[model samples]
Target: MMKKIILHGATNCGSSNFGDFLYGVAVYNYIKENYKDIEVGFYNPSEYFIKYIGDCKISLSKSDMLIYIPGGYFGQSHKSRFIDNAIQFVRFMPVGIKAIFKSIKIGVIGIGAGPIISPFLKYPIKMIGNKAEMISTRDNESYNALKSLGLDNILELSDLILALNIHNLSDTTDQVVDICKKCEGRKLLFVHYNHSLLARDIFARQLDTFVEENPEYQLVVGSDCLLSYDDEYYIEFSKRVKKNCIQFNYDSPFELIALLERVDAVLTCKLHVGVVATMLNKPVVCFAEHPEKTKRYYRQINQPDRCVSLYDTSEEEMLSILKDKIFEKSFVPDEEIDKAKRNFDVLNELINKK
Candidate 1:
């Protein structure tokens, strides 16, 4: 039977993070390949609020089904603001209830929990989970978190971006490729977000020290999120290094994947950046803001030693880990990719069930 499916996540948002954008791509591609006859519509969560509550030209209607893409946004709070929490509750609760009323099958994929400072958010999230026909969490911590709230049917699936077929994707532009391949076998990619300014600076100093110590390798900065704070930190880090670090504007996920192929290893604080590197079979040293989420992902791919806690681990420890672990060759097994693909099967089964 054909259905009008409304896929929701951080899609088509101007300020969306690249990692989130990749999740959208993965979900969209999977859906298009599987459900060719279904009418699919996209909704950005940020924009959903604007259209739902504010005066907007576009509006969201009750659909036959709703699929929320996989991402670590369940417990991610911005400033831990009460008003923000209130708005989120109001924004999602009504839709979730409406979905139930309309018998709209709801699915949430590759979502994680934690850093949820507010107790108020627990009920709303639980409500959505209870209403969902299928909930595929990306990591165990997320599964545990959601299970702790009495939601027991969640599947502990890995991140969906791992299922993306990057092997067939086109390479980046010649200019970008040339810049990325400057040092050939000695190119290392660095990616980080601006959640903590102090941590960002600490990484910058460490990167400078690493560059000075290892003159053979060239550091290349990759932007995962297009935030002003991150851009400013990149500039600051480049200046402090006193070396020419090549920075590339990855406007799309394919370009970033191409750049990853050109680099030897990845050192990143962002979750998806590290995941993508591992997908490309490159060694990655991850600085995890939420240790649970990163550890969960690493555990899935059988690389538990790759995740380092930003709070507990020092810069020297991270650099040491990079030297000991990240430089070594790593292989992403075919079984791992198959495991991620199984998540899509779970999604399809839930959606197409009688």
Candidate 2:
């Protein structure tokens, strides 16, 4: 029987991304509810695990399992530098290795992988995938990529964020509620863009045209990331767009969801913003810089057209697509959510074993 488990993910290291934070919370909450007797601790190797690797090993040795919670950790993104990704890999590698050495079960769940161009990144991830007791990816691309790498222990599951019980979240903050109240009559299009200046300028132009043509909709420019640059990007975007836009800054995932609930639709470059909006049954259009994960997610839900290339799609085309998608009916199928919940099944089975 499992007595202790340490949760590891980007969120454990105080990541400002709301989606990462939510992933950590969702996994933690699920374990607390389902594995009531198991002791849970967060292992944030990114911070000091390298410097204190010996101590970390000792701590992890006591644990029965180590769960690598959901996010796109296995791949490279334009948003992050190669060195940053390398550092992340380095930090987690020793932890996983030591856990294996101690016979501690390691599970990598609801992870998104691939577009792993560099052998440097690919090989280490392959090592982890092979060593992991069970590895479940959230997207088809991830599952197939790992499979091609000769890892046979992987399963394709939907994103863990889909399994969230959004209804249990606290009430919308007064500030967000007030903002929604102020824009009462206008259909709010929630907008979050990546930090690329070129992408921002292109998106701004498209949105300007969109609002110019459709005056009934107003833009709510904000971020799913609390990183300073993300805030700066939206603030800059608001200035570039011709239409008046509301700049939103949220402190927690709950606040972000609250704002999402108030919005009519979502247009974002960030993956999880679109994912969360889809979960809320809000129509979403994504400008994917790295399209693999986003495109796979949309395809999984039978809404492939909603995911579009950030760089290749022209302003006119983007404007047209945005107009079409923003008001379109969208819903996450019950089966998809059921599939997402299977992300935890491997761990559940291990915990229940005699």
Candidate 3:
């Protein structure tokens, strides 16, 4: 009999937030490609289970394992007060607890965590960790955060999306494909920034100056997720770029990958945007959003020089970094790939155990 496994994460496939959707897709693809004998499904706790416990109960009846994929949702990092973040931290506790109560094997893959200063979150974190069959964090900071809570059996791994097989995106010629084809030889620059990270007006002026200076390059501004603020921010940034800048968003991970493959480099204030850009072998210049989460990933891959903070650097300084990166040659480190492969290998072993 084929054992059923659920790969749950913040997946809203083709969500405006492209990175989360990619993580979900990467988890799905990893299992399908490596564990052919097992049946797999993807779940988003926020989207699917809040109103449908009965559906979860039915799915859990046949499920042998539950593997939570990568995301920053596990910690108390959202823009909320102590009580609010505390409330959010336990948002998925009912589901995880239900899985544990039923004795279903649980695992976590390439997840992020940090600055979890609150004692209130410790119990639930421990509860989830105690139930996990395998635990692999995407960065050292997250590993340390979880370790601070006494879960020392965790493995540190690269973000799962780095190991994602994005070549699958080229199977069809959708709008993303069409854009890539149309701009085949033109040097493309992809930009994705978060409003929460920096002042949009200042970022826009810097972007405008960068575009004006580099008139030869094509500027494509976009959002990693389609959250209301994402479009609002992107649209605002576009208006500031006196030079022509294209705005685009896709609802398919494959389409996003197809579009990313054609970009020469990426400039962003989001972690996953930088991760996906590096996975595609493009140079990434990042405005550090959260220190531990954003810079730690680059440092793990041995590229700390790529990270800069908007607060610490002027727009000119930021543009200078972008200028250098535009001409810079970049490649993925072999050790990083090996580390990512080991992550899935361990995850697969945990799932296949009798």
For model 1, the superposed segments whose C-alpha errors exceed 4 Å read 12-15, 45-62, 76-94, 115-117, 184-186, 191-196, 229-231, 333-335
Residue lDDT tens for model 1, 1-354: 636676666544453566766666566666767888866656544442333223211224645777767766567453557877775555444555666677778888777675555656777778778988888877677888888888967887667776777766535777566785576666565545445665566667777777777777787775765555656677887787677777766555566677787777777776777887787778788777656567677877778788878778877788788677767755566776766777888778776867
TM-score of each: 0.86, 0.89, 0.85
The residue-level lDDT of candidate 2 at 23 comes to: 80
- Alpha-carbon lDDT of model 2: 0.77
Better of 1 and 2 by lDDT: 2
- Model-by-model lDDT, in order? 0.68, 0.77, 0.69
Lowest lDDT sum, 10 consecutive residues, model 3, at 49-58
TM-score, cand. 1: 0.86
| Candidate 2: tens digits of C-alpha lDDT, residues 1-354 | 788888777744545667777787677767778878987767753333223122332157778888888888788765567787777676556677677778777888888888776666788777777778788889788998888888987888888888878757645888787788778699988877755577678779888888888898888877665555766777678888967888787556677888988789888887888888898899999888767677888999999889888877787787778888888967898888998989878667656755
Report the Cα lDDT for candidate 3.
0.69
